[model samples]
Target: MKKKIINGFLQILGIMIVGAIIGYSVGKIAGDSLSKVDTPNIILLLIAGVVVFILQVIIHEAGHLVFGLLSGYKFISFRVFDFKIIKDENGKLKIRYERLAGTGGQCLMRAPEYVEGKFKYRLYLLGGVIFNIIFSIVSWLILPSYYTLLFALIGFVLAFLNLIPMGFNDGMTFYHASKDETTRFILHLQLEYIYYQSIGKNLLIEKPEIVEKINSLEITNTNYLTDALEFIKLDGLEYFFEFDALYNESRKLYIERDDLLPVYKVELMALLVKLISLVNPEDELLEELMNDKSLKVRLKQNNPQTKNILATYENGVKLDDEKALNLINEARKIKNKAPNLYIQNLEMKYCDYLENNIIK
Candidate 1:
């Protein structure tokens, strides 16, 4: 309670300080003998401001994309507001229209493992802010129009704000990721697997170092990294039952931190476990998870077909060949991206096996 009050006071104090500075800057600029513009010109200036602001956001995300791809990371998805572009199973980019909670835009990339790759991801993390700073400086130099000046101001503020290490922002993740070798190493390997999967490669993969670290179990308490490693290790394991134990373990970890956890992220991971582990999740359990008002709402909004498929998977044992095939067709026919493509493909593969069709 005391800490909250202190933090709140500090936030207000900082806002007031910034406001004063901005007011002073405006007064100084206005007093410098600037000519008054006509109403039409003013309207054009406002439109330019809006256009430049949007353009800057695109430039910011592009920074991350450029740095990430150059740093041995593969692009997974790029989202701007409700529009997302994700790589499909055939390694083709597919656009999905969806909205994420409390986020404006993001570029997701998967990092590959390299033993000597230290501080490499820092560029990917700070790419947006770095680009923002450079762009602002260039804009100030090249175009000193009022709209451009406003753009530079917003750009500088955005760059600096992204540096504050809080929430799910790049700064906090970068700070945590850069310091933790075990977690970072595991993530690299996991991403490497996804890269291979993107090109239709899947195999049982193991890393002794990762296994040893997981077994030791004496890491930071309730870390997302731990949850990630716990679940990520299950990838590409052929035996369905092998995934069951880890699924439970990871699910427990996720449940403990459910409130703070990103729902779709963890649930998508859970879907992977359920499908790859080849366990037909208990009907009650499936209902409990998918029926959870929060997840249900998201699923319905993002991919109603996926929500149907999950419910279908829970009752898979009862569905005959035609029915199972129909479900797979329905999911695949959906224009938007599946919530968990890996899971969807796995389920479809399982259904095909029942249908006695050769899977390519």
Candidate 2:
């Protein structure tokens, strides 16, 4: 607890220092431009700022896509906010709407084949930072207008934040990957696993070696990579109907991992509710999880897995079979519409399991 508090304090201090630097830069650049105007339109400036931030985010993710392709990684999906361009099962790009908590945008790719314990990783990982920095410089050099200044400033700040290992950002991943052999290997495995999922291949069955490797990793919660691998392991366990193991692991991560990502944490909590309901509907954890206002808000998303878990909870614990059936039906309807085909397949199977084996 002391360590976590110290880390949190350090992170806040770093952010404040960086913010001060960026603020001074912004003021210096914008002051000259503002001096020329009789009155500044605050609302217009605010709108422009928002637009510039979004554009920079797009540019950053695009950097990842371009560099990932160059590094021999295959594109899976690119998202800006809720809008996404994803490759469908037919190997064609399609537009979809999806949102991931704690991310402004994402660029996912199928990693190139791992050979001799190594693969191209640096370019793909640092692509966004490189792009943001390059664009910042280019934007500043091209024009001296207000929009240009904002663009340059925002881009630079984005690059800086991502280039430093603060959180689960690109810089953090790259930093760990460059230093740790295990991190690199884990990235390779994750990318390959994503590729298999994109093509409707189950790593657990067809690539049991991959599953074994993933499950063998140490879950120190020191980095997001370990947590991610553990999440994948949970999926494999769930795939084989090992609810006992799933519940225990999910509970362990949810309770023990103070550094757990919000995305993983919420999913685990929801999964726990479902598991407890299935195994022992009378478990006290169910009441607490179900009544959690924060968890309730997060679970209100349109995600298939969340809906499936909610469906199970309603059926087994609440005895609201009608609502449970509706939730499962809704999950099935949107399963194929998921950005990742692997998740789509998983949700479909889960729905089937609930209907055929559990929900009846």
Q: Largest lDDT belongs to which candidate? A: 2
For each candidate, give its TM-score against the true structure: 0.68, 0.90
List the lowest-lDDT window of 10 residues for candidate 1: 31-40
Question: Which portions of model 1 show Cα errors greater than 4 Å?
Answer: 1-50, 69-77, 82-100, 109-113, 116-119, 200-218, 233-247, 264-293, 308-310, 313-328, 339-344, 350-360
lDDT score for candidate 2 against the true structure? 0.80
Candidate with top TM-score is 2
Residues 1-360 of candidate 1 have per-residue lDDT tens digits of 586568758866765677568547754764432344322377787888778777777778888998898887778877777777878767788776656675667777777556755736788888888888789778756755566567777776666557666445677667667766765655555565555444444423334465555566555644455555545555434325354564555465555654444643545543543443245544345545554566655545535345344434534534344565565566556534443355445545544553354122
Candidate 1 TM-score to native: 0.68
What's the C-alpha lDDT at position 295 in model 1? 61
Candidate 1 lDDT score at position 2: 83
Candidate 2 residue-wise lDDT, 254-278, digit = tens? 7788568767777778789889877
lDDT per prediction? 0.59, 0.80
